[model samples]
Target: MDAFEEYLMTNLPEAPSFHPVFNEALQAMLLAGGKRFRPRLLLAVVDAYTPLLRESAYPVAMALEMFHTYSLVHDDLPVMDNADLRRGEPTLHKRYDEVTAVLVGDALNTHAFYLIANAPLHNDAKVALVQELAYSGGIGGMVLGQAIDCWFEGEKLTPEQVDFLHEYKTGRLIAASLKMGAIIAGLDEKMQRELFDFGLDVGLLFQIQDDIIDATESSETAGKTTGNDEDKNSYINHFGLEGSCERADALAARIGERLASFDAPLRRSLEALLKPYLARHKTK
Candidate 1:
């Protein structure tokens, strides 16, 4: 993780223009730092499979983090969640301006592909990484989920509908993180698919835990805005806090069982990385 952080610090996106704050805004959220959850997921798989490629995988991991950070930047914009804080710091929009935030998000989102394209991997793997990231993070996946979430804020959605909504909005990118790692490790198609499916469940549980945190934690404790999803169709909103906690517990259990089924290296790596996070909602 420290090595990953060092790579990010040194390889930050550089855009030189008449604009001074543009560069600063672009680097702000990336430096502010979150859990690096997506990047860590990708790297864990790489470390388990091809330990030698771990360093080479840094750019890919960084790309995932950049893409995720871009989403956070845009999601915190005035028109989205209207969040004031993220990663224990003021959001890009709050620190700079909406225009800066929008452009920074755009830069990070596009540069993610650039990072993958430039990574020192085989051309085919690079292309596959780009395709996976685009497909999962693009319109049919994360964008679709966000579209549904924003469009149906106050409207009641069925539990199934909510699952579908979150699967794309949040789950797809997370699933892609795992899939991308598998791609780098040159895993079989079947293995890749299995990891992707596992990641979807993990992603859904992640979102539920987030909803639980929003309902219960303060902005200071959460390192971001809380109680901001009142208008948003979240698990906590649809099911009361207790119900959401129960759902999270069940999902965590299933995820644990699946984790146990993996081979020793991957299982141990992921279990160590994920056990605390899987039951985070309960902790809150």
Candidate 2:
């Protein structure tokens, strides 16, 4: 993972533009740094199954990170969450302007597909990778989740509804990261589906843990704006802190059991990447 982070840092995609600061704004959030959890999930799968292909898989892993970063940029826009900080730095809109922030997000979003399209993989695999990412991050998945979340702010929802919202908003992309890795490694559809299902649980647990963080941690500690879910339908809002923690605990256990079911190599790689994250809710 450390080596992968180094690779990501040095290999940010370039977008030549004549407009002043356009290129700079485009790279700001990405270079500011993030957990890169989604990319790690993708690369871990590739490493476990096809160690020799790790280098080739770097671009695909980077595409996942780029897509995730674009989401964060848009989410922080004044029209959405209106956040001022992200990844421990001023958001694009705050650093530049709303127009720059919006365009930068759009650029990252489209360039993510471009990365997959040009990845050093088979034509069929590249097509599959593009399809998987687009569906997961597009209107049917993450976009729909965000729409539901923003449209229903200050409105309480059922637990099942909340799950549905997060599943699309957060879970699908995480699931896609694992499944996309499986596609690159030529894993059969059955195993890919299994990994995707497990990833959804992990994603849900992540959202719940984030809610706990928003409730308990400071913005400085979180490296982003905190306590921003007060009007939004968050797990912590639906279920108080204790209940949300218990829910995260149960979900983490389920993820653990699923992780154990995988073959040894895959399990080991994912365990190393995910163990700390699975139990993050308990840390606070």
Candidate 3:
């Protein structure tokens, strides 16, 4: 396991036997296998910019993972997608109860901020990181996106509307992952914005690929619910499978070009970080 996993295992919430199951539900949802992409992205950005800061980046990375896991837990709730599986295992709501899953999600969301506020970085950096996460995952970001998706189910959204939805719902946190790393590294505002834009492109690509996967793959293969997007406003709904695939490819190429434009070592490090995602576009 990675240091993040170690930290999670060691620091997971503990409770009395009367409510041990609550904490256990949180652990099960969190420790369920995931790609850890957001945290890895944060670490990679730190590594590319300042290797010495890698150690200091762990808490922030874990915070991102926690926030992401919280989102997944809530997304799979009966009130949302009503998913049965996540990461190839029963969803929190499925294994436990709806109320437990809801509380676990809430706990993870708040704990994510606690981790950020208590991270070893300077106070100013911590403040900025917290603001970014709140904006990305809060009412104007992920929540807004989800609300739009839920409200507009079965409605035919224009391409622009679809982009707006995904940008806030899925892209904001991904963008924040890179921007948070830049902030931790003390990079200038210009470089931070550049990285944020790069993250936006990557985020769009990821969502488009996700829509494709939902259409083409199965729940077992994806380790989560599939075919759920068919009734919602999604890239596949607006762009169709072939168009969505082409758009994902185009975005991947754009991101590759952007990475290549950076300085030699930074370029190489960023490319290495993105290799798996880029490879997915090609193989798909």
Candidate 4:
């Protein structure tokens, strides 16, 4: 198996075969393909800070993915983005019906906490992970970001306002994903911060790349409708293509500098992750 695949297989959450609904929900959720960047980053974190923390960080990482998936599911709900597709498949609500989709998302989000809180890892470590996930996923991060995005959509925004919207809306979880990894390994605050900073830049670049892709790629290639942000403010809309490209490059380069401080393979992988954004710019 690939390193990522192995990492995923190693730390699966324990489920009673009897909980058919719960098991089916989880399976349905996981089978949906995502970038898996967050969980992998968490694993990378475990590798860097303390691989010895567990024989498998999979369950913990998967928990984070569940939370993320929950966000996506809800983000596409009728009252939200109102999208009809995801991962090149019918969205949960579209496929399973709205009630099923909403409940499934709720289940995943809560179950994510359960998995990490009850992880076979050390109690202190598991407790810390739970807090991190909650803080990042709750008011501090993804949910708040979505709230802001919804509130601000179809409205005018200044540069700072746009930046704040983007940072909270998308950048927070990206930063948290990295910090969660570092925290899982029990890294000190200073080191954890450095990783968080690195995550912020990379996460920003990821969002910018999405903008560029939306501007340049077709809906078929991107799996979601392109130009959806045409009505919404984005780095590309405000900064324009060339300016966004310049910003993405500068951000990625700075992240590269920070990644250099770490000898860990995960850090190296993150640094390499920037390469795709850079390459995407050229294609655009």
Candidate 5:
């Protein structure tokens, strides 16, 4: 595992792009990266069950990052989140024009499936992955979430409504990333169920952390625009700070207990994945 981590860090730069334009977009997104959480989660589940598939895992994981980057790019447009900062740099829309940002997002989104379909993977599995990515990113998942959120803007929403906003928008992709890795690793029904639950809990807690960060952190600390969600119905607003903390701890504990079925190394890494949320004891 240590050796693999070393390899991941060392070989990250070696994945060559086939064209200059493709490489340019990939490089810009990668250089202005934030957390690399989705790709890391993809690698984790694949490594848990099928370490031999790590080579394929890289392209698969890279596709997740690309797809995620596209979402962020479009999310920051004037029509969407209107974010000015991302990964501590000007957002694509801010650095470039809105048209370029839109194209950059479109390019990344399409290129993700492009990489997946052409990856050194079995045809059936590649098709399955492409389909999953499409559903998760399209009207069924992230887009649905965003639509709900945008529609609900300026309207009073219950906590359930807020959860609805995030479950599809944020949770869907995170859950898909987990399930996709499990699928690639050929996990059985039981493991898949466990992972799905764990991913949901992670996603739920993640949105909570996002809300807390918005209330507490400066844009500099968060590496993205802060205080954005406060304008929207938020966990912190619905549940007080103490209430949100309690919910976060309870969610983490439940998810942590699910790790009992996992191996020691995977459990350790999963714990690390939860740490940021757990230790996010206060706002900034």
Candidate 6:
């Protein structure tokens, strides 16, 4: 197991039968691996500044992952996407009961805050990080985005509306991943804002690529249900498949251009982190 996994194993809740099932279910969902993209982004930003901060950044990295996992758990609940599969395994609600899944998501959400608050950073830094996360994951961010998505289901949204939907829904947290690292590294405000913009572009590119994949790939290949977005509002619904792919490529190029503006070494490091996703776009 990696450091993050090891930390989770040691720190996540365990039990003596009072609620073993809940703990077990939460652990299972968490340990069921996904991309780990957000934490990797956080660590990369930290590494660009100083390798020494990597160890200290682990808690913050894990907090981001935990919070992201919480979103996935709740997103897959019966009342939401009602997904049966995630990361190539049964979703928590399917593997356990709906109530267990709900509580597991709740536990993870609160636990993420605990990790951030207890991290070994300065209290001021901690406060900033907490505030960033709260805004990204709370009412004005992911929650609002989700609400808009659900409320507008089956209705055609304008390009501007779709952009707004994704900017908050997925972009905020991804942007926060980089911003948190900048906070830890004490980067200047201007540089932090740039990193956040970089993350936002990447987030938009990711969502568009996901829409293409949902339209083109199968569930078994995607590790989750595909074609489910056919009935929902998505980039593919507004733009055709070819149009979405083109948009994704343009977004990737934009991200590359933005990354190129950084100092050479940091630019290269960030590019290396982005290579996998960029390569995917090239294959199209």
Q: What is the C-alpha RMSD of each candidate to the true structure, in Å?
A: 1.3, 1.4, 1.8, 2.9, 3.5, 1.7
Candidate closer to the true structure by lDDT (higher is better), 2 or 5: 2
lDDT of each: 0.91, 0.90, 0.85, 0.74, 0.76, 0.84
Top model number, lDDT: 1
lDDT of 1 at 163: 95
TM-score between model 4 and native = 0.88
Q: Give the per-residue Cα lDDT of candidate 1 at 84.
A: 93
RMSD of 1: 1.3
- Any idea what lDDT model 2 has? 0.90
Model 3 lDDT tens row, 1-284: 87767876677655556785877887886677688888888888788878898878888898999999999999999898999999999998889889999998999899889988988889999999999999888986888998998899888888889899999899988988999989998999998899888888988888888888899889999999898876888887887788887898888888888988988866877777788677534334
- Summarize candidate 4's per-residue lDDT along 1-284 as a digit string, tens digits: 56655665554444566754555555554675668878877777776557676455777788878788888888888888777767766777777678878887888889888888767777887887788788878887778878887887778789888777777777778888888778778778997787777777777888887788878877777776566676577888889989988887787777667777777666665655545554424534
**Each prediction's TM-score against the native?**
0.97, 0.97, 0.95, 0.88, 0.87, 0.95
Higher-lDDT candidate of 1 and 4: 1
Candidate 1 collision pairs = none
Query: Model 6, stretches more than 4 Å misplaced?
Result: 15-17, 280-284
lDDT of 3 at 222: 95
**Residue-level lDDT for 190 in candidate 6:** 92
Per-residue lDDT tens digits for candidate 5, residues 101-176, read 8887887788788778877778877887888789977887899988887887777688888787777888878877
3 against 6, candidate with superior lDDT: 3
Candidate 5 achieves a global lDDT of 0.76
Separate clash counts for every candidate: 0, 0, 0, 1, 0, 0
Error of 5 at 2 (Å): 9.9
Prediction 1 TM-score vs. true: 0.97
Question: Which segments of model 3 are wrong by more than 4 Å?
Answer: 15-17, 280-284
